[model samples]
Target: MATKTAARASVESNRNDDDEPESIPAPGAKRHHFLDPRRATGRLFVATAVGIVATCFAPVHLDWRIRAVLGWDTGALCLLVLAWNILVRSCPNETQRRAGAEDPGRNLIWAVTVLASLFSLFAAVFVLRKVRAWTGFEGQLWTGLALLAVVLSWLVTHTLYTFRYAHLYYRGGRADGLDFPKDQKPADIDFAYFAFTIGMCFQVSDVVVSCTRVRRAVLVHSLISFVYNTTILSLALNVAFNLLGDG
Candidate 1:
């Protein structure tokens, strides 16, 4: 009877084990999406806001002496944004050859942005020189030169990156996607692009000043950029109004 009971218990344990579900691995962990438009826009807004606040509270006047200096600084900022954009947009073969070179589309976007930045920098310098001449600010010559040097350095760095990435893209031997379409009227596009580029320049300068760990310089430079740009925009609007009114 004891032997019979043991055999029955063994049979019951075997049945229970057979009835249990087999373990299956969970679906491969979902990948986290890092780039979202909403997040990017939010970051841009925050950066712009911080820059504006720093400019407003800081005591700095947009005097003729400082106009050239501010112009150069703003130009540099525009250049950086353009370069950043290009870096995102460009798709190069070398980029894919390296580890973790996913998302060619984004790479292309960065490349375009960088190209735009270079153009904007050139435009800013041209515009600033005109502004300086118009305003008759001779004292800021040294400052202007310094700004030019910074811009030149940026251009050199950017050119090297551009050539390397472009070569990779051309040589990679990949199928081309839909080309980037140009939208908006030429004049309107130019104005909007320059305005936004200049705005970014102010924001970049603010970051630099803050990073220097000098609170006062940051505040002062921020204010200078804000006031100068404001004045410039106002003047530009006035000119447009007069031209349109005459037309």
Candidate 2:
């Protein structure tokens, strides 16, 4: 009977060591989730920018038709990204694993995202021609500029996700080590993260503007961007905390 009991204990120990993907942590283990600015904006920027391009380039007779086919009207894709950030929240062990090896692949993701943001910004400018011709608004040029910047607003929503990813995955991890002190004069983190922050700001602003234009309503856009902008501000504060914590 004692032998059987010992065997059972050993089996349970081994089983506990195996990784259970998508499973919640066992009882008594605490998990921490932080607000990430990057994540909040990531989905908003990527999806909105992509949606705009589709709207401009699709063979459909009208831009609205393209939006219909892409299902871009409801911001479904951005919402999925927001959900993904929640799902990928890390436990302590997973956080440690992220610190062990750098994922170079993320560099490509950042680069592509940055370029896409720029292209969308320019495209918004190019579309000014149409807005001026179509609308008798008093300030057509200014409105076009503002609308061009809406994707940045939309992207701002996910900056929380991005910054949280940085906190959990990069704080004392690989990129954290490369980052400059946030407190020091002209201080900064890794170039990739730095670029990511700047790009996200623009991306988010673009989204906010774009969505507001699409809905022609401020209540939803304002409420959402308000949440996202708060995250972006928090991310700035976190960069300082991360630097201090690492020290």
lDDT of 2 by residue, 1-247 (tens): 9999999999886554332212232333233332232233344466656667755665565455223334342343454455345435644344334322222233433543344344434434434334334444424433333343435434433343333333322332322222244422111122223334433343322222222121222233234345444643344344335434444
**Model 1 regions lying over 4 Å from their true place:** 1-60, 63-138, 141-247
Off by over 4 Å in 2: 1-59, 63-80, 87-106, 136-247
Q: How many collisions per candidate?
A: 25, 43
TM-score of each: 0.25, 0.33
Q: Best-fitting candidate, measured by lDDT?
A: 2
**What Cα-based lDDT does every candidate model obtain?**
0.36, 0.38
